[model samples]
Target: MTEQPNMDAGAATGTKPLAFDRWLEHFRGNPAYHRLIEADIDWNGRSMLDEPTRQAFINSFQRFELGESGDGKRLLSKAALEGDPTYLAALELLVREEQKHSALFRRGLDHLEAPSLEAHWSDAAFTVLRRALGLRTELGLFLIVESVAMGYFTALAERAPDPVLRGIGLRIATDEQDHIRFQIDRLRQGFRNTPRAGRVLIGMAWTVIAGGAAAVLAVDHGPALRACGLSPARYWRQAMVGFRRAAHSVLANPGAEPLGPLGKGVH
Candidate 1:
């Protein structure tokens, strides 16, 4: 298969807007893209980290795996109500890719001789808070989550002690960025007709949500961040940086560049 999806992960630039249909094609064609990533992660059940660092990473990883391990049934039910066949179909494939992230992390844990966790307070809290906001699936929440993930994985790739974790980070970073932009495009479409003042208000709300999520994650995943040579504060800042870029792309303009990374190969 192709090394990358066949579409740029287009989320409109601050000066333009992105289309949702392109995202559909990207997910449609690359259904099992994780297979490509797996070939490169050849860790045959080896613990590559020292004990102290290994435990920290395992603690953090188990939480991430728990979040990614969903089957998307809840979300698909929501999509069915929305009656958007295209998005529903794309989302089904997207969920598979998200599950792949869990699978990859699970494999890493097994290789490290670690057990996946049954639950995490942060995961539960995030869910509670997300549903607590009663808006049309808000899509902005996905933007916040994936934005954090993209930067978090990049840190793992650059600073983690283990080559296998680094490989998984690098591979998953691509998918996470695409996921971020997918949500961005969807949000952009929803707000395309709103007045500038309304968009600004929405952006402000989004930024606040992003900030809150970033702060909590900084604390929630602090140990792994430290193990990987990234401080919680620094990781939080990096997450905000990505979120701002995405927010501007979605709420700034409808005639600018998109965060298109699918066909172009994600950075």
Candidate 2:
């Protein structure tokens, strides 16, 4: 196992000690998970009158689920192979929950009778990037993905005409919020421990990924937003605000101390 810096609860006098590991473990199976599962809506009866609108939503949802499941599985596998038991455990639970999310999205599509969804990013770019970077880099990417997903789900919940779809979106959005928080915390910690070049790479990668995801949403749901009483400019502005808020929170947090020379020992 990689040696992580042991945080002493009483080290900083007069200040509440930050219990990173404890908090991570505490949120492993958040109540939001159960709530989301329970609140999921059946979308079988609903119909999007426009073919383009229905197709776009189906494509977006499918790609989103595939991306999530792929990322989760990769993270869990890497953590386990690296012998980082704490991260591995956390990711194990997280991946399971993500699988549920993916399954629900898939089921929703089946209800709509949309065509089979294909992987969105099948090129070598993602694979090469993943191989070149470490877990920290992956987490940075995930932070952006989850943050954008939160916005997309929130919009879906507000606009979806079907009660079940709306309920599902709300519940999923809640869980997504928790996921975003967890990822942001992890990114902060990663920034602290990672090398300068690595940190810069992470930041750049996050920006690119965030931008790409946002574009995907815009392309997929532009009309949907209009239908929901939101203009293009308004939806874009709201999305920007949400993304910035999430990014700011991650950047602002003073993270855990770096492992420093101990990082060498881990290798």
Candidate 3:
């Protein structure tokens, strides 16, 4: 947003790529988000209930999916209507994939006999935000949220103990990784086409939204982590290291050359 050098260009020219130092810098400055991932892992491992607690935990987890997928569908529809063809197509694919995720979670909930709540509130929130700030801002918010979710799901997949849960986590993680790539590709194109001032505003908005969401998750899940054998602070440090390594892979990948323009805002 601040017109950083084209970080992906080196990869395009078959040269060594720019490192993810910027992303790591961003992550280090926001331990709150890392804490959320750690707490989720801790909770899933410890507080996730044997049977009675499973209902409540499943309900909460379902609500989270409902909220997230509802927002994703709305954002995708809006993007299809207003964005470029390539971007919109990718977003549509993501939307369909997210629907599958939603259904997958719903199946799990149903198998556990969990109650379903209306997800209209999530849609309402997205609509309000879009009306207030326009499409690009909404997309930025979506991307940041999706990125955090990707990291969370990936970490959970790596730590899950139960075979079924591990399988689900890994599947969701794969979807999330694809979602991240789609968002990165579209956001990069958007940044290239956007006015410098507008890009800055969107980046700032994304940072705020991502940071706020991370804080909320950490607060909600921190106690759960404490209940587990893991310390929240320690788990957070480990997760950050993992996230940094993943970010490095993306930043250094040859295929990510097209994302050069948006590199500054990727973390």
- Candidates sorted by TM-score, best first: 1, 2, 3
C-alpha lDDT of all candidate models, in order: 0.72, 0.57, 0.48
Least accurate 10 contiguous residues by lDDT in model 1: 1-10
> What are the per-residue Cα lDDT tens digits for candidate 3 across 1-267?
333222234334554433433333432333343333334432223334466445533644565557545535556556555424444555555565566667656655554567666754544665576555445555555565566455445444555433334445555665565455544554453344345556446455555565555544444444433333334455454444443333333333325444322221123
TM-score of each: 0.84, 0.72, 0.60
Q: For model 2, name the residue pairs that clash.
A: 41-164
| Number of the top-ranking candidate, with TM-score as the measure | 1
**lDDT measured at residue 221 in model 2 versus the true structure, 0 to 100:** 63
Better of 1 and 3 by lDDT: 1
Candidate 3: which stretches are off by over 4 Å? 1-49, 52-56, 71-77, 81-83, 119-127, 193-202, 221-256, 259-267
Error of 2 at 209 (Å): 4.1
lDDT of 2 at 79: 54
lDDT of 1 by residue, 113-208 (tens): 889998888778777765644223346677777886677898887788888988888777878878887777666555555578877887787788
Candidate 3 Cα RMSD after full superposition onto the native fold (Å): 10.8
Alpha carbon lDDT of residue 231, candidate 3? 44
* Candidate achieving the largest lDDT: 1
Q: What is the model-wide C-alpha lDDT for candidate 2?
A: 0.57
What's the candidate order when arranged by decreasing lDDT? 1, 2, 3
lDDT of 2 by residue, 49-94 (tens): 4676666567666665565555455666555554445645665666
